[model samples]
Target chain A: MKLLEDRIRQDGTIKPGNVLKVDQFLNHQCDVALFDQMGAEWATIFACKPIDKILTIEASGIGIACCVARHFGDVPVVFAKKSQSINLDGDQYVSKIYSYTKQREFPVIVSKRFLTAGEHVLLIDDFLANGKAMNGLIEICKEAGVVIEGIGIAIEKGFQEGGRELRAAGYDVQSLAIVKSMDPDQGTIEFA
Target chain B: MKLLEDRIRQDGTIKPGNVLKVDQFLNHQCDVALFDQMGAEWATIFACKPIDKILTIEASGIGIACCVARHFGDVPVVFAKKSQSINLDGDQYVSKIYSYTKQREFPVIVSKRFLTAGEHVLLIDDFLANGKAMNGLIEICKEAGVVIEGIGIAIEKGFQEGGRELRAAGYDVQSLAIVKSMDPDQGTIEFA
Candidate 1:
């Protein structure tokens, strides 16, 4: 996690309202090598768990989950699409969540065939802010009767309650980099 | 290529409206091992080009492009955002594209900072039908003044004009699986 913390310190920019932009390497533009390394770290952390699949959301989470899947024995990565697609079938587990980034509520959908009963699934994503998106996935997981193995997040805002709430719910959430605090004016960030 | 073709034949379903759903292993639920093999295949095909970055659209393309980046020496994978997010800056290369699956027009946006002038880029996507999305990326690449070495596609509908038109436009488009024809009624598919 030192490498990720350092990368965030070097490349991350803090904007007004506590927005940390790491798009140069993390989100919009991705560094696959870094993703692979993050995968290795998460694999080490979740070595004891049985991970049958990696569940993630669309867009940002797909790259990280796909790259990380290699470390988890090339597990099938099931991404929850943001909206309904014509390609999707009627048998789907859907959960609605509000995305502060997009500023709208969209349904996270996954085919029921992908998640079987008693399957161990590890949820993965780029960032865990307020836990709305992760909560959506967890809701679908509950509905599908899949076992929640763990949640692997690249960056977690410790100041936010997402990570704390999941831990309180008795979930093993492993975040690579936890931001304790950040300053937009002076451009500074502290890790937990 | 044969591996992908075989996968499609086995798991792909032919729906009405010329839709071939391979969500079991390709887009929704991703098989990272298969994606790595595709990366290897594309690496071999685009070996001669100097690829500085792998450019793709959001969602489906991000997973394949990230997995494929490993085969291309860990090149940076820049995914075009489908909409304008508050996280994105003002300086951007924007192109509008119409999606048949979503039945709407969306903006394809790439941050100006990620793309540089005179850089070699390889465009990647999950599917190429009418080439609207690909063309949008190409337009951004042109505006950014980047050199497009090639366009790598996982599947191309040979019955559609996307691949043929791209080839006629003097782009090296490599599609692993090209569908010559498919019958939804008969549940049969023929590869080109």
Candidate 2:
């Protein structure tokens, strides 16, 4: 987590309204090496759980999920589709996710076949803000009758309630870096 | 490549309207082991080229790009955003792509900072159908003044004109599996 926090401080940009721009490495442009480290760290934490598949919501989450899946003995990764595609069957477990970054509510979908009943699932994502997306994925997992083993995230907005609420609910959630606060005036990021 | 072809023959489904669904392994439900094989194969093919970054389109392409980047000494993977996001800055190289899967046109955006001039870029994608997405990515690389060293595809629709056009234009394009045709009525897939 120290490496991720340092990377954020070095390359992350803070704008008005607590906007953290990490496109240089985290989102738009990805650092696969860093993701590998983050994945290794998550694997170490979730080593006790039975993770049959790693679930994440696209498009940013795919990179981290793939890297993490590698460390888990090449476990299958199932990404919840955000956009409507012809390839996806209509009979899917759908959940609504409100994107704080985009400020819109959209449906994230996963086929019923991909997630089997009673399978242990590990959820991963790039960022956790309001936890809407995480909740949506959890709902989908529940509908599929899968057991939620744990949740892994690269960055968590500690100031937000998503991480706190999940922890309060007794879900094992691990975040590599938690941003406590960001100040545009001071051009600084505070970590929890 | 043989492993991927075998996976398609075993798990791929043929739907109506020339659609071949391999969601069981590729795209939606990703097999990290198979993806590692593909990454190794691509690394063998594009070994001579100096690839500084792996460029791919969002959603499905992100996973393969991430996997492939690891073989290339953990090169940066830059994915083109299909839709506009608050995380993306105003300074971007944009291109319009016609989607054969959805039968629509959409914009692909890449931050200008990620791609630098004269850098060697390897374009990676899950499938090459009509080649609209590949074309858009190529255009973005051109606009950014980056040299596209080669292209790596998981599957290529050989019946379509996309691969033919790109090859005629002298791009070193490599496809793991090339589907010659698909018969929905017979539930058969022919590969070239």
Candidate 3:
């Protein structure tokens, strides 16, 4: 986590609206080695839980989730689709996610065939801002009757309530780098 | 590539409208071990080229590109964004792509900072169908003045014009599994 925090400080950008742009190393342009390190950290923290699968929402979360699944002994990673595709058919576990970044509501869905009852699901994501996406994933898992093992995130906006809310709800949440605050003018970033 | 071909034959579903669904292992639910094999295979083919970065379209390609970047000495994997977000600002390399699957035109954008001029890029994707997505990615790389070393695909629909068009255009394309045809009723699949 220290390494991630350090990397964020070195490469992350602070924009208005409390956005920490780690896209240089984390999201858009990915550092696979750092992701591996982050994945190992997640594996270590959730080592006790029975993680049958790793679930994530598409685009941003897929890279980190893919990397993390390797440390979990190559566990299958199921990414909830943000956009409905012609490929995805039949019964699905669906939930509505409000994207604070995009400012819209989109349905994230996972095939009922992929997730089944009693399966232990580990929800993973790139950032937990308001926790809408995380909650959507959790909702899908709940609908599928899959046991929610824990939540793992590469980065968490600590100023946001999503992480706090999940923790308060008794869900184990682990964020690799938590941004406490950001100063755009000073180009400074504080991490938790 | 045999491992990939075998997995596809075993787990891939033949759907209507000439769709080969490897969603169980390739698209939706990902297999990290198989992806590692894929990365090794891609490395064997493209390692001789000067690949400074791996460029891929987002959603599906991010996972493979991230894993493949490891074999390329952890250079970096830059995935083009399909959707616009508040964080994506400043200079960008953008291209228009027509999605046959979704039946729409979507703009794929990559931050200009990521793909520098003269950067050798290897485009990685889960599938090469009509090659519209690959073409869009190639266009972005071109706009950025990055040299496209080659293209790597997990599955190539041989029946589609994408592979043929790229080959005719003198692009180096390596697909692990090339599907010749699919029969839905018999659940039969042919690979070239």
Candidate 4:
């Protein structure tokens, strides 16, 4: 976690509106080595959990989830699609969530064939701000009857309620880098 | 590539309209071990090329590209965004492509900061059918002045013109599994 926190401090940019742009090494342009290190940290943190599969949302979480899957005994990574596609068919567990980035609501869908009942799963994502997207995945997991082992987040905005709410709900949430507060003018970031 | 070919033959489903659904291991629900093997194979195939980074699209390609980057000496993986978001800003190289799954034309946008001039990149994707999406990436590469070392595709529909067109354009395309044809009624898939 210290490695990730350090990398974020070194390469992340603090923008207005509490935005921490770590795209240079996090989401858009990925640093696989850092992701692997993050996976190592998560594996040690969630070492006791029975993770049968790694569930995440599309576009952003896919890469991180895939890299982390290796740390959990090569479990299959099931990425919930943001939109309905021709390839996705059959019975599905769907949960809708609002995206402030896209400024719209999108459905997070996973096939019933992938996430089954009684499967222990870990939820992974790049960021958890408002927890809307995290809640959607939790809803799908609840509907699918899969046991939520824990949640693994690469970056969490500590000032936001997403991480706090998940922890309050008794879910084991392990965030690599939690931004306590960020100053755009001073370009400083504090971690929790 | 035989490992991938065999996996496809075993787990891949033959669907109507020439759809070979390998989402069980290839895309939707990913098998990381298999992806690791794919990365190994691509490493051997494109061994001589100087690959500075890996470029792919969002949703599907991100996972595979991240996995494949490890085989390329842990190179950075840059995934082009299929949609605009608050996270994305500044100068970008944009190209439009039609998605048969979504049934709409979408823009493939990559930040100029990621894809710089004189960098050698390898274009990667989950599926290459008509090559429209690949073409869009190619156009962006041309505009960005990046050298495309080669193209790595998980599966290619040989009956489609994408592979042929890319090959005709003098691209060293290395597809793990190329489907010669598929029978929905018979539930059979042949490789090229």
Top model number, DockQ: 1
lDDT of 2: 0.91
Per-residue C-alpha lDDT of model 3 across residues B1-192, encoded as one tens digit per residue: 889989988999988899888899988999988999899998998868988999998889998888788899988999999888898999988899988777788999999999899988899999999999999998888788999889999999999999999989999999999999889999998899
RMSD of each: 0.6, 1.0, 1.0, 0.8
CA lDDT for candidate 4 = 0.93
What TM-score would each prediction reach against the true structure?
A: 0.99, 0.98, 0.98, 0.99
TM match of model 1 to true structure: 0.99
Backbone clash pairs for candidate 1 read none
Where is model 2 more than 4 Å wrong at Cα?
none
Off by over 4 Å in 1: none
| Between candidates 2 and 4, the TM-score winner | 4
- Docking quality (DockQ) for each candidate: 0.93, 0.86, 0.88, 0.91
Q: Which of the predicted structures, 3 or 4, would earn the higher DockQ when compared with the native?
A: 4
Give the runs in model 3 whose Cα sits over 4 Å from its true position.
none
lDDT of each: 0.95, 0.91, 0.90, 0.93
Best of the candidates, lDDT: 1
TM-score of 2: 0.98
Every prediction's TM-score for the first chain? Answer: 0.99, 0.97, 0.97, 0.98
> Candidate 4 DockQ score?
0.91
Q: Which model is ahead, 1 or 2, in terms of DockQ?
A: 1
Report the Cα lDDT for candidate 1: 0.95
True contacts kept of each: 0.96, 0.89, 0.89, 0.91
Q: What is the lDDT of residue B7 in candidate 2?
A: 90
